[model samples]
Target: MNNLINIFFLFLTLTTSGFSQKPTGVWDAFAFGAKGDGKTMDTKTIQTAIDQCHAAGGGKVYLHNGTFLSGTIYLKSNVTLYLEAGATLLGSANVADYPITPSKYPTYGGDLVTDKMFIYAEEAHNISIAGRGTIDGRGDDFNGPYLSPSFSGRPRILHFRNCENVQVRDVTLRNSGSWVQFYQSCRNMVIDGITVDSRENKDIEKSRHADAKGRNTDGMDLVDCQVVRVSNCFITSGDDGICLKSLSPNESCRDITITNCIVSTNASGIKIGTETSGAFEDITVQNCTVFDTRVDAISIMTVDGARIERINISNISVRNVKGTAIFLRLGARNRTYRKNAKAATGILKDILIENVQGTRIGGYGCSITGIPGFLVENITLKQIRLRFDGSNKPLLSDDDTRKPVPIAPPAVNHTVPEKIDAYPRGEMFGRLPAYGFYIRHGKNISLDNIALDYADDENRSAIVADDVDTLEIIGLKAKPSPNVSEVVQLKNVRNSPNLPKSN
Candidate 1:
């Protein structure tokens, strides 16, 4: 049986390797009157080349050594858009050039017509965008006045909907007005070795605010996707680095793997769902590094009535996190229910996090919280180390006495309020009572070989548990502080044999 399993894996590896080789029968864009000069409007010419290539039994459409200015161009089936070295596919500045179509998903209160994307593909199979060049969305020109109350007038760089057997590799994508790449309902997708720098554009500084240049410029948004693999990418963006969502009903985001990625962003580094209407399962994230993020390093939440289970995360290192290092929440924010249908609460269970380390975290420390009657169950944390800046001094104020002093006392026997309908965020519950971790309303939780270090002496406990059942804390180490009298505090906790008594 072992030998047969090994042979099966070997065959799978070989099949994947064979698929990476370039396709044959390349058709150059310049041969079809596509002037490579930066000044020419080559939307129609370049698209014609792609159409001819697709009509001729599907091959690579090559762009080489110049800038091809284009508007929205639809990708056909069995087509590969290859950008050679020193090549660029630039987005046109005019919004009217890209025609609009009605959105497939419900847009709540927003406009129905929102299909103005730079490079779009819908219901196409065997499609790819590969090679070592760049796709530059000249996003500064589309930052006009707001078109609707919910959405702006800017377009995304790449949008693929309902595409199967897709691959995107070894390209540089930058400066998108909205999300850089959005893969919605795509199956069997592979994204590898891509570099994304969607930071604020320096060429045209139109916004008066400092961070408003690339508003809503998320690096990658995968919504309702399945069988996806994202690896070896470097992303720096203004919004969430890599986010997964389930926006459609009756469709789930499942069987996804993200590994060996380095991310730096102003928003969450890796996140799942602020729009979870379907299930999310069988996800794994490993060997990733996140730095200089304004939000949590890893955030998992299912606030919109979805079941989240079977998540595994390991070998993560985070630094300079402006918010919590890790956050998990399960709440009741059912935004997608039909009229007159009863809202349902979600389920969260079977999560494992191991070999994680973080440094320089800000005020709202790590948290795992669930609503009143619904507990986050079967969570395990092993071989974890965290460091937080425990200074009670106000970050912006210089007054030393402004810092509140600690008062040692027994754990308060009070139940935390269940903010079921509030917006789900790491900082949604004001200032956390603990410095390292705060777990509330959980079941079957375990923490092993965990260490917490603080930079300055401060008043809160290193760990706190409230309303938890079947808790275990083994080999826990916290830095000694004169102000912090206790390392662990328990309130209304049951079956906690390993925890020390609070003073």
Candidate 2:
């Protein structure tokens, strides 16, 4: 009996290896369960086909014009999931079918298992999932009972981790569980001409448990990644339309460009995290149209102990904002990670906002706040027109919400670097601001060609700089608003450049 068992095991191994090594294309091998005896589940056959293709050589796993019900199909290196124009790859509703495996799982807060994504691809190169058809996760199947009780369950539609040279275009990804699309630790990713739809409304609040709300999905989230360009996409989700986050203080997420997109989010139109810990620089978000968001239309925040710097925002427009039009927050609670809890917190600086217009802003026109020991500097606002709704006028507070008092700059830390001693040189774009731009305990800050339009007369100043140094402002203007007084100031200023004309 023992000998027989051993022989059977050996034969099974050989057969499995042989099948796994077979290379089959569309014509040679086909798994058509849609017509094969209604009970014929083609999952095993399709897996065998993909395994064979990978074992021999990577090629396309083609699906014809039929409904192919599949469980999380893992694509190997050099393999592609190609669908015909009329094909639809339907996902299995049984949650048990997708066994918990090591996929591209990006952890947040203290829990690593709270949010698990499907369709995960990790550590692969030159892998593509392209088609004219659809790769629907059927996210609604996992919506109730076993889902999050407070809000709703999250299901990630397509998640790619640590991948390279990935291109996703001409696809319709609807009914996602959590984030519609998420790419982490990836490089050279291009996402164009895609549509993301959700059933959740934007009236929900944003917090740690925002995912529990219905369709509380982030359209696209790129964290700690590089060389990602997202353009020409329409995203209307229950949460942020398009958000980029890098909260780990040890790493840097740089070199990302977003252009020519239409976004109508429930939260922010284009936002950097309140949990931003790492540095986000060399980012360009331009030529986008946003409408009807509950939060800021375009927001860059560094709460807690995070450091965000060198972000360029240009050529964007927003309509019907239910929150602040544009808010640059450097408050005390932005830090979601404790990596930098020891160091004196950093600043959110070198941000350029140019050619942005909005209608019916629900909150304050704009607010730039800095916590003690950290400053919000080198921020330029050029050509901005913000009109707010007349109802639900919340009292705009001037009381600094930051706890730790802000630091003061060195009185002798003059702008002119003394011959050989320059105060830690840093590269910058555009000219520095002279007067309208404020600074405190911050060195090497500048603003040029920033125009402010205060259409509301019952509000406060347009630009206020309380405690900062080495500040520069040029060409500042405040368009006539109803009851606004003294729209720009350089309060407690020191060792700064000359003020420009406030037209």
Candidate 3:
């Protein structure tokens, strides 16, 4: 038995073959009493196929040429769920069809987020879901407020926790009741060529923000995972298109890479942490395109006590952006990982973003801000061009993400409240004082070869720095507003060519 098991594992490890070739150990779901009619509940039938495959030391549990309606089918070790062309694994519309299974790996706010999923794998190894097919969560069946995470009954399409050697490739994922997929506390995962469309309403402008189909249907959420690569995908969603979260400080997400993707979203295009209880280290993002985003194109945030370090982002392009090109905030929302546990402000440091271009950006521009007493550190932005459309109406305290713009900069106290404990978002600070960059409460920051401009005339400075230590700016090309004297506004900034030799 041991020798047979070893042989099965070796076979799968060697052969990641394409869909055209029928794998040797393929177990067809149709043979296991799956009707594949899109109406009959094939939950038990599909589960049986998975079990048999796992019992046989693991092979492909195949579904082909039909829509297999299922609910809460669990994956196991060394098993691959393969879907052929023109096939779909559809989720049951009834909420009770998906039984609640708590995650095996404990993470921060797990209960608060979700515990229900359609295709779940826990404590499993060498698992994969591949082939040219679709997994439709039927998200319209579950309703919630737009862009808000539902604490009530909602089902994610895929949830795998405490799993290793996982892969989900070349599949179309659609219409999750909540997050499309959540890979939590898993390692050595590869998600490639998977397209996601999780939005109930893709048009943020015409609908006037009415997402009745589903709320918080993020494209994918990789939480507390390590050694992951995501590439060659297109994502459009109601919430964050591609997101990484550290839901527990004890479990960090390390060595993650995302490249060669196209994203369009009503929320942030790519983001890290508003849940943040764990560290994120050695992450890289490259060769991506973002368009028609209602919020930040690239956002890094740490509100809870997690450390984010050694992140590199480059070669990005954005068009028709209604928010900033880049946004980084270190706040003290500090919600505990578990109940009654203490939480503190997290760290956001050692980030490099370069070789980016943004056209038709909003007036809100980029904001890199840390709170008082704790500063964001060692940040650099180089070879970037951001051109705003000169129309900006930032989100209000009520979370009205899209408000009408005024003619010019408002004459009021500097932009927003501290909102120290509020949710960290790109528009959390409202319209910034500057139309290009507003950086404050930071240390050891540098900006090189930046060009900030607008199509129409503006009434704010291009760049504003306040309460920064050890700052440097080189090769900046910016035009000031008609009302301001200098292109760059400085207040309480130190160690730069802009200031005098002495205080």
Candidate 4:
């Protein structure tokens, strides 16, 4: 009888232990706040419950069809925040309640500072926040201070840093105080089927400011991250739509891709490097649409000495660009980098733009600027058609609005007036074009099919290759009207032996 009793007790113990080891759903079990009728304002209790769930074992924490007010939620690995349809996670308004820590600011620069976010995770892995629920950051609460004349605003709505294998999908993140979403130094990250909207304010000018304006409120910012992909997302805000950034002037950003996305408003559509302290390479942006932007539709710049190279932008359609359709500038300025106790600067190279189409370019069709020898090179513009409807060329600066007018070739011989000459002088019509096709100063380049159209009835160049080498034009076409000829013309003087013609 004693042996039998002991056996029965052993069996019970084993069964209970196995049952405890199984994954428990947070709501079904009282790990955080009591699964409260799923109605009460159980903020602290719910947070406590979530912490307990993480400590015990990773599992699913849920908010099902109710309004839940919360302050900073920390998520751990092997855990997921699943929200049922119509559920809302409202953020706390008091700034002090959400304390700042060493967090990342997607743009401007990086250093730890105090900030708040709806969902935040750092240095963790294998995590996901998925469902049909809405994560609302009551941006209006945090709006006053941010909009103050002196305020620079906070970072982003949702941020994840130094994490691996992260997934954020099917969530509506709206009215963020700053950028809608930001991912910094994260790897293997995927963001899909996300919808963000912040256009309620009608003050178009103030809404576009980098500070009180949308400021750094980009739709999605991927910073110094690898193996990152953003797809099927719609973003419209007061700032850039989809942006990729790196520590300017030094580090390299690789293996990043953006596809099948719609980005509009405020500023550039898809941008890389205004703060480029780092190098950007192996980047591909394809099948996207951008319009109604105040600045360049697609702009790549490194003024503070960032070495950018190996970028591939293809199958992009842009319209109504208030600035240049494509603007690439390598500033003749110095970037400050620390050595022993001082800072220094350098140059940039290796960029490409291909398969791009634009309509109604308010500025120039394209713009490229840099210095001598250490210039921007190996850039290509292929299969591109641009129609500039405006009469005035987009100004590079307030005083420099005179559009670059290409010199025409002799009418009788159909040859460029000047022979292939040396630096600065031969490029009197413009700067020495390096390896360009239907354009100028872009070097060692090729054009499969490129068209440049002007509505101002002024002359425009079909192809401008100033100071370049090894250029090939397979199918080149241009129409510089008689009236427009004084302002623009087409001439290929690179003297390459193999210039192919499709017609």
Best by lDDT: 3
Tens digits of per-residue lDDT for model 3 on 22-48?
Answer: 446898988777899999999998898
All candidates: TM-score: 0.86, 0.74, 0.90, 0.75
Instruction: Please give the range of 10 consecutive residues that has the lowest summed lDDT in model 2.
Output: 422-431
RMSD (Å) of each candidate, 1 decimal: 10.7, 9.6, 5.9, 8.1
Q: Hey, what RMSD does candidate 4 come out at?
A: 8.1
User: What shift in Å separates residue 7 of candidate 4 from its native position after superposition?
Assistant: 15
lDDT of 2: 0.60
| Candidate 4 accuracy as lDDT | 0.59
Summarize candidate 1's per-residue lDDT along 71-121 as a digit string, tens digits. 888888999999997999998888876777666543323234555588988
Please give the lDDT score for candidate 3.
0.82
> Which candidate do you rate higher for lDDT, 3 or 4?
3
Give the worst 10-residue stretch by lDDT in candidate 4: 419-428
In model 3, the clashing pairs are 249-277
Ranking by lDDT: 3, 1, 2, 4
Candidate with the larger TM-score of 3 and 4: 3
Worst 10 residues of 3 by lDDT: 391-400
Among the numbered candidates, top TM-score falls to 3
Error of 4 at 74 (Å): 2.2
